[model samples]
Target: MRGLVESAEIVVADGMPLVWASRLARAPLPERVTGADLIWSLSELAASRGWPIYLLGGPPGVAARAAGQLVERHPELVVCGVDAPPYGFDACDGGREKVRRKVVEAGPRLVFVGLGFPRQDRLIAELRRELPDAWFVGCGAAIAFAAGTVRRAPAWMRRSGLEWAFRLVSEPGRLARRYLVHDLPFAAALLTSTLLHRLTTAGPPFQQPPS
Candidate 1:
């Protein structure tokens, strides 16, 4: 997880806790930047600049619906195409070739891969050669969020860093262990380490000169 994030071209605080931790370290970030928000932001940029974009990943019909939603909002946005491969498609060469063909045929300027986590990042890494000049974004579930297939947490919960709780409640069977067991401890450790680093790095205090 750390390696994947470190390798990313642009890494932002996707969760509110990260933003809060930054503040605790006295190095505040501009704001939390989630993958869902990036979809809208990038789409707006594409609309203005006449850049055609491709949507890849998400469940069947999801990428297509997300593309429609974006085009409806931004008339000038050019949606080259969408290709939502089957689950675990990344593990197979046939599936990879299919996605490569889509990108080759579309020739889009930007491609959003919303397959989630390491999977999306892995796919982007593998397909970089297919469209060397195009921008490939590992957007996780941004396409699903944009398509309205998955509901996001309430604004208050999101801002308060309880969005994970909300999502856990929404999908307990699927997310319980991930949120409570894995992510919570990792987040705590990360914040603690950040604070400790800040404290240890503080040098000697400045002394005032007297006449």
Candidate 2:
């Protein structure tokens, strides 16, 4: 686990469930880190620290808007560049490498990758091996929210963990199947399986590595 984390450019705790799990596993986490919050915090920190930043992924123009908004909010922040990749993963050709080279040349201290889910995680893992100096962070849809391209749930809704409800209301057509039909069911199944395993097992439980 330490090897993977040491290999990572910047390891971020993404899912709330993961954060809670870390507590149960007795892992020492610095904080309950969310991608959206992390991006803004990093921007503010970079402003005073003078570390250049690069944003990659999201819908067309989303990255630009995010970079612009961040610069406006933190005038001292140096946003090195921004790039929005194709909608589909397979559609992207040299786009990834292009972004990589641009970031390397810009010599940014932080690079936020918003390709979403496993893709973003995988990319950062790869970059961790390839680019040792530049810190890579995987932020799902963070660029869009930072850009105000997508409206987040109200503070109350977020505190209640009902942010998914707000997203569903805002973009039903796009997220209906994802939240309702797929993820929810899969999450329930996993929870049930965990409970059953706990009931059947007698010894100390196994733990997942940080990676």
Candidate 3:
């Protein structure tokens, strides 16, 4: 199997189960790469390396607040900009186009997108042609965590693969189907597929190198 390749800089195993499974399979992975952690870690790295970042998504003031907090935490970090825009797939007409243009013009080294699932993933993928040099990642609600609106699960809970439960409890209505139905089944299927492929294949599983 492809194992998981990203056209961007790096793809961390954000989900707890994926992190543990990768360890079991002996796949070298960075520490559980939550978006918030990624932001902070990358911010520090970028500061030393002189890489700029852009934060896209979050509710109205959330992105701005998150950017503020990030800059505050890492005073040397260079944040190109922060914009929230709309949520649904069909962004406010030219909104997505405008964002794409901004990213290209800004020439940032990293672009953290928070539109959540398929939307953020698809948007970043689509923008690849325009923003070739930028490492665009779909960070789900990482921005909210940075904004202090949501709390991440404790280390133990995260390691136990019950971070979803913590989040479900925090925002039950928004995440009912996501945790209980959508992600759970999807994750199960992914695990089954990975294991089956590993057992059946002769060669070692491919690992994506840092971009």
Candidate 4:
């Protein structure tokens, strides 16, 4: 995952924790830029430019529903294709090739892939090789969110950096281990390291002049 992130042409801090960590390190990012937001923004750009876009991933009807929502919002937007590949499609060369061929035939200018993490990114890399001129966004669950298939956290929860809590509550069985076991420890370590670095690098407290 780190390798994939490092290799990306552009990377933005997607979580408030990362943004806060950057501030603690005295190198604050402008703001968190999440995939959920990007889906709308990028689609707007595509619409204005008359660039055709493709939607890929999500459940059977989700990609299509997302496309409808996007087109409804941006009436001029051209959704060239929508696809929801079966589970484990990326694991087989034949299935991947079929998807690639379909996208190539559609010839969209932008492709939003919601397959999640390493899988989405890995498939984007492969698709990039086939369509060097096109742009790809590995957008995780953004498609489902756009489709209204999944409820997003409320604005206050997002602002307070508690969106993960909302999601965990919503899908506890699926997200419990990832949030509690892995992400919690990593966020703790990141903040701890940042604080230590700041403290160690700080100058000593000022001394009063001799009377």
TM-score of each: 0.89, 0.77, 0.80, 0.93
Best by lDDT: 4
User: The CA-based lDDT of model 4 is what?
Assistant: 0.91
For all predictions, the C-alpha RMSD in Å is 4.7, 4.8, 4.3, 5.9
Name the Cα RMSD for model 4.
5.9
TM accuracy, model 1: 0.89
Query: lDDT for model 2, on a 0 to 1 scale?
Result: 0.76
Across 104-129, the per-residue lDDT of candidate 1 in tens digits comes to: 79999988988888888877776776
Model 2 bad stretches (over 4 Å): 1-13, 18-31, 89-93, 193-211
lDDT of each: 0.85, 0.76, 0.79, 0.91
For candidate 3, lDDT tens digit of each residue in 65-182?
9988988988888988888876663456586778777778888898888987667776787777786777886788889999998899897998788899999999999999988898
Ranking by TM-score: 4, 1, 3, 2
Please count the clashing residue pairs in each candidate, in the order shown.
Answer: 0, 0, 0, 0
Candidate 3 wrongly placed segments (more than 4 Å): 1-9, 23-31, 89-93, 188-211
Angstrom error of the Cα, residue 203, model 2: value is 11
Number of the top TM-score candidate: 4
- The runs of at least 3 residues in candidate 1 whose Cα sits more than 4 Å from the true structure, single-residue gaps closed, are 1-3, 200-211
State the lDDT of candidate 2 residue by residue for 1-211, as single tens digits: 3554566545666544444444444454555567888889989998898989999889889999999999998999999888786766434657667655666677678889998766776667766566677777878888999999899888787765577788899999999998899867765665566567666757665555777
Residue 157 of model 3: what lDDT?
92
